[model samples]
Target: MSVQNRTPSWPGEQLCNSCFYTAMRTHGVCPRCGHDGVLPGRANRTDPKPVCLTCASIPEDYRCRTCAAEGQIYRGGRCARCALRDDLTALIVDGAADPATMSTIVEILCGVERPESILTWKRSPKVRSLLSSLSSGEIPLSHDGLDAVSQRTQEVSHLRSLFEHHGLLPHRDEYLARFESWLTAKLDTIAQPAIRAPVEQFATWHHLRRLRGNSTPGHASERSMLSAKQQVTASDRDDQIPHLAARHPPSHRS
Candidate 1:
């Protein structure tokens, strides 16, 4: 039997997105297809339309912010903050940074008021050992680890004060230029393989934004630098060693 498609005449009933069937039942999977129901489209309806947690709007294209995977949009882009936090934790576990340092970084990023205490705690010898491991390439980097770097550096007391004084507004052009130059230097010194992916991802996201006209020339330049850095690093690898021209012919290789 064909299902009847009818418009509801009741005061509070509304139609579903998939099917035109109207009902007063506000909750539960659809009776016909067992799929989730769309929110009722009514002015007085109290139920809010499902929205992403981070951006607070229904995601047009659902994609996880962390893993960049599909089918994980229910929790607002895969819990961006949690994913970031976990990544940082992994970096700490791998000895990228001392636990104290990591804690200080987290406190700053999470907007903790007592950042001084955490910073002091991170200055211990035990914490210094972990940081040494990170410096010596004994431990790998992670996405969260890179985020911690960004957050910690951005939160320098003086810089934070300056930002607050400037109304906490984003100086996109200025920041873009500085970030580009800074990252170029970092790529030369950074040896951790695990952190590279996230750093590149961060750069790409900025590049896309700049391309879309949401950013400025400085931003574009910064992205260009980052892209170039990634290419240079890849070319320098033994597996994909770059071709070098010889001044003399092959016969000279006696």
Candidate 2:
């Protein structure tokens, strides 16, 4: 009788469905692949380095260690190259990346996913070039960081539009209320010297300027009218005293 070779099915012989590298043995886990829990065959390849998903050309080691991504990487691990590409699309509806990298930083910031990306991009050569061009006034702000500034301006415009639609155009009480809440939260961090002064200064200046501009000609006229009436009353009182003296006559006139 010829004996047929049979594959043994053990308690831990399960394989990952995605990558067939790691085998689930007695521990029911593929030591070779950490992702066997999700997919049975998923395995980590022995490749020295992996390639970034967005930019397959770049080595994985060159990408962000956290997200395994690279280039102008955002908080969510977006690659800088991808961000610059997106920004270029946003800035030039025609899809031109003139001045090459200026708009790149702006676009990344305009659709900013991670706050940390701002600092990272700032330190990047592309961002430095953009800033240098801006400082020298060589590049127009409209064309330079236009995307980022435009995004903020657009947001404000959008909010204004929504407010107008809801009959809240002139009514900023809700916005003020929200602003106050935000201010309170920010002020609560007063212990941090870096944050306190600038926030307070800006808030103070904004409120003061707004209040100063809020007075209308009609309100000013009303105030003036009230002042004039008060002056007339004072004059009338003075005349009354003279009249009373004449009426009483100089009782002791002798």
Candidate 3:
């Protein structure tokens, strides 16, 4: 049973850093003089957590917004793990990051002095893909994945700087088109000639060519294996005349 359920008419009260107290007030506002503009919870993490309205400590309602968004823990207010601590909290009103890996990513972003530079960097295909994967929960916390993300972040930053120098930045579509063209050219370069041809037909062609070159008259062993019952028309013999003449030289050199 909850406090509201236990006491039907009891005014709603929240967990306080001082003690269990009840008072009518708006969000982040308390009757206590010391708790001006302070809410009823503590920050267990860098995100946000139930904190004492007075001292901004915990044991109150709500979890850290950051950890919830990242799907991590709900310990307290902002910690070291959050990547976009302010940005995420502002956007989702919430937002750990994998410390070792994400810290590296943060360092990459930190190198960008301009805000627009960061925004433009996100337009890159590799960076966009990485963020999309993270949002969709497709990314794993493996070292390789984090390393790729870190590397792309630096690359995106460089690209953004280069674009800004020219005049303006390109959109995601432009980046995507260029990537697709590059990928296609690379694939074509590495592709085998037989890749587009039908396997069975190509194999048959190869076998016929091999037979034409290897079938000669000198080997009596292979000649004995020829089908005795087969009917050979004049056209077949005509085909053999050139080969037969080549195998045996004329009595006198022509």
lDDT of 2 by residue, 28-139 (tens): 3234433222122222344422222222221222243344432233323444435444444443323333444444334434444443444454545654554555434454
lDDT of each: 0.40, 0.37, 0.35
Reference-based TM-score of each model: 0.21, 0.19, 0.21
Pull out the clashing pairs in model 1.
Answer: none
Which lDDT value does model 2 have at 212? 35
TM-score: which is higher, 1 or 2? 1
Q: Candidate 3 residues 97-181, lDDT tens each?
A: 3334343344445344433345445546776666445434455533334434542356544533443343333322222222233
Question: What stretches of model 1 exceed 4 Å from their correct place?
Answer: 1-77, 110-254
lDDT of 1 by residue, 151-251 (tens): 33533323333333344334345444445555556655757554443344434443434433555522445555456456545543444321311222233
Question: What is the overall TM-score of model 3 with all chains considered together?
Answer: 0.21
RMSD of each: 18.8, 22.2, 22.3
Best by lDDT: 1
